[model samples]
Target: MKLQNATVLVTGANRGIGLALVRALLGAGVQKVYATARDRNSLEAVTALDSARVIPLQVDVTNHDLVSRLSEQAPDVNLLINNAGVLSFGNILEVPVEKIHEQFDVNFYGALNMARAFVPAIEKNGGGAIVNILTLVALASMPGLATYNASKAAAWSMTQSLRASVSDKNIAVYGVFPGAVDTDMLAGVDMAKTSPADIAKAVLHGIETDLEDIFPDPMSTQLYAAWRQDHKAVEKQFAGM
Candidate 1:
């Protein structure tokens, strides 16, 4: 489907990549974009855009009831971007149960819940697409971010499963594996990170080309290439670090 004249809904649109996506879609000439966040008031940036084009909707994808309700309410949506994610740094074994649970709920299952809730709506709108934002660390475990890695890994698995499940329905599911991005989520982490605008532009380009999986930046592309060619080497590299 073309980005132009499309009605889109992006979760966690108040900040970070989600906010960038709303702007990117607008720049792509989309008809309307529902920029959703946990709190609509926090989306002043999105609202500052053309109010007629960018609609600020309150959405917490982890809330199943709200997800289903939004799906019903916005049955005409053509694109769904599941960008809502939480990162709780620590090993799964050492992190508090609550933190681990929060990570899983917001990072992994949150995307899944949104997909499940919106599949019918997307199909009803004539086979739109779903994009699940992931991370390169999902391909290889990282020490300091073990819990975050685990959550994204689970999301990667879910993305693969959903891709197959939704293919027949004409609902394209794109898994986006991006490395460190310059966003609040990666604040203070010392790593070469890509700009959110670059990633957002790459994602839109991928969607336009009908790419199923998108590596939105050089860092993600490099890591994904290594993982595909020498998974063990990359694993050992992270393991050693």
Candidate 2:
């Protein structure tokens, strides 16, 4: 769908890829962007844009009631970006189960809840787009981030399920798999990471191209390519890492 005059909602708009996406949408002439964060004041960066165009919305995606309220508030939304995510970097067996549940709470169920709440709204406002910001870990689980991997993998599965069920409604579902991005989330990672701006730009391009699965970075594309050849090889490689 065209970005100009699009009413977009981006979760986790306080930082990282979500923040970059908000800026990119504004640059693409989006008329209104509902930039959401758990803390409303954290959306100051979006206010740095045209305040009239960027609406700071306070929301905890995990909260069912709040999400319904927000969906009702923005019934005209055309583009929904499920970008609110948290990563717990550690071995799953070693960490408390609560940590795994917490990751799933935000990363997995959060996206699902948002999708469920916004589907009718999107369908009502002429078919729109829903972008789920997943991770490379969904393709191959890493040793250090087992919980995060599980959460994203579940989300990736749900993305496909959602697409199959919603495409008939004319609402497009795009699964975005971004590799290591230059963000606070990858603070100590010793890998080459792409700029969030570049990822955001590529994502918009992918959306325009109507790609169902969007690999927004070279790293993600490369890994996906490898997985296509030998899924076992990629799994073994990440398992060792």
The candidate that wins on TM-score is 2
Q: Which ten residues in a row have the lowest lDDT in candidate 2?
A: 88-97
TM-score of each: 0.97, 0.98
Q: Candidate 1 — number of clashing residue pairs?
A: 0
Q: What is the lDDT of residue 60 in candidate 2?
A: 97
Task: Specify the highest-lDDT model's number.
Answer: 2
Model 1: lDDT of residue 80: 93
Name model 1 segments beyond 4 Å from true.
none
Tens-digit lDDT string for candidate 2 (1-241): 7888889999999898999999899898898999999999899877778888988888899999999999988888989999999998888778688888899999999999999999999999898899999998898899799999999999999999999999898899999999899999999888999999999999888888899899999999999999999999999989898
